[model samples]
Target: MAPRPNIIRIGMLVYPGCLRSGAVMPFDVFHIANTLSGLRVAANRVHFDTCWLSARKEKTLTVGGLSFHPQPADLEALDALMLPGIDHQGPYDLSPLLLGLGPEQEMLRRYAQTGKPIISSCSSTCLVAEAGLLDGRRATTSWWLAAYFRKRFPAVTLDAEQLVVEDGNHVSSGGVTSYLDLALWLVGRFGGDALRQSTAKVLAMDANRSSQAPYIAAAMIQDEGHAVIERARRWLNQRLDRTWNMAELAAHCHTSPRTLLRRFQDAAGMSPTQYAQQLRVERAKALLESTKLSLEDITGRCGYEDVSTFSKVFKRWARITPREYRARFGLRQ
Candidate 1:
């Protein structure tokens, strides 16, 4: 393939039922990137031109009960395309809605054949899955719909905890609000990383989110067999400083080790060890935010004997070094 030009042309899928903000945010972010790029030198500048596109030829389009003027799509002319979330009512079957988008699915299939990126988040991720774009691919969707998404699209590797997932050209972000994450990522991809950071600062957006773990409420994870997982989590939290033992965790949770592993993995999307590590990281974040503790002190408090290992794990979960996290979000003395 030839080199892509500095001017990125992106297309957004527009339809009546999609969320308004989902359609609007990428435009807003790219608009900001374009504005900020003007202040940069020629070599550092990157620009964007975007279009609101629909499968049908419509004079005026209604999206999420609001109005939009959209062009009939020309996928070949664009560098990439984005899909906005359809209004999905949760814990319910979506076959009817997915089947109804015949024209849109065909459009997506045609576009996929070109190997250009098709980015989506929230409920519209189901649309991409239904269209067969996500098969054998790792993707994510709104966490509430994760069970249904896994059942419906078993071929796709669904990691619901991550805020954004970039597998090849198809980037999937989590939830409706994560469009900001996706948009900033696109800015960095086409406009360069510095431009992305500058645009994020102007927009007052934290563009470095690595996971959706911080935002997922504990209550949301307590469904079905999750009570056992919760019990195991509590046990792990209390014993963070001690070496982890699956047998002991299972005994305390009143289940066999096999059952505990299966249930915890099913409920939490991670193994018990991973969960233990995450719990330790969360505790470390609190200490970092509230106290002027040294890294060594925080490391021991969060179950790691060494600051180096603690720092590595903290960065993996938080997407920044503990010191950086503290510098940005820590309370001043």
Candidate 2:
């Protein structure tokens, strides 16, 4: 028998004030991929060795109110180093952490020299910029901090409108939710589209939805109509497992069914029913990719009344059968 390939080691750097969402989201996504793949024989086995790297071994608090203790290792051994965002008030807010990052920065610089990937999200993009890794590179961050980032690092081109920006070995994403997009991209890059599709499916995300340009532009434009569309989207996202009808959705949005249909079409470029189905299909994809649950269970959980109907809808939307999609993207059962 052949020896198992080495698992990719991902080092997550958690500091005293790191954002919990930024640090934990990627970990959860990758772990789900590992779980789903392990259930089948032919699936590409992904071993994710996550170590929390800190300047000290003392207990640290996360911005989301979680406390953790990390290993004190030099960052050299990591296949990838993730710098989570911090809520820094100004330049002074980052000095302490930035001061101690010389060793970490050195490791990142060496990794860049060797063509390894370096990822940062939200305010963490500042760390990469400060390290001069993004000089003359296009990157992005949370819109609120875009101007400051451009001012602080004049050589780096900032695209505040993009959810995630990839420049060679460096990847940066906008806000907390955009971390999902960045994680999906990494899965696609290293693990292949099957893993990427599976991870996105598990997350209930739309792989067809470009994480860049028009989608981001649509998200940024906030008007009264946009607010209504957003409210409808939130309602749908929260009730993916429940059967949703056009009348019920219209009532929830305080409009007639026809008006709701027209507005939803204008806002999201799809009918409300179509939008709901899209969301369901996205959820179904995630379930298939991340869990060992039976097809029946996934269909029910994603609000399908019957497996036949569910399979048909999934195939129509995804352009492949669920089992085939799973086999292509996941390890064979």
**Best candidate, lDDT:** 1
TM per model? Answer: 0.71, 0.57
Return the lDDT, model 2, position 169: 83
Candidate 1 C-alpha lDDT tens digits along 75-188: 889888999988766545467878888888999999998898889978888999999988999998887778678767889998888888888878998879888888898899
Backbone clash count, each prediction separately: 0, 4
Residue 210, candidate 1: Cα error in Å is: 1.7
Off by over 4 Å in 2: 1-6, 57-65, 89-107, 110-114, 208-333
Q: Which ten residues in a row have the lowest lDDT in candidate 2?
A: 214-223
- Kindly state the number of residue pairs that clash in model 2: 4
Residue 167 error, candidate 2, Å:
1.2
Residue range with the least summed lDDT across 10 consecutive positions in model 1: 216-225
Best by TM-score: 1
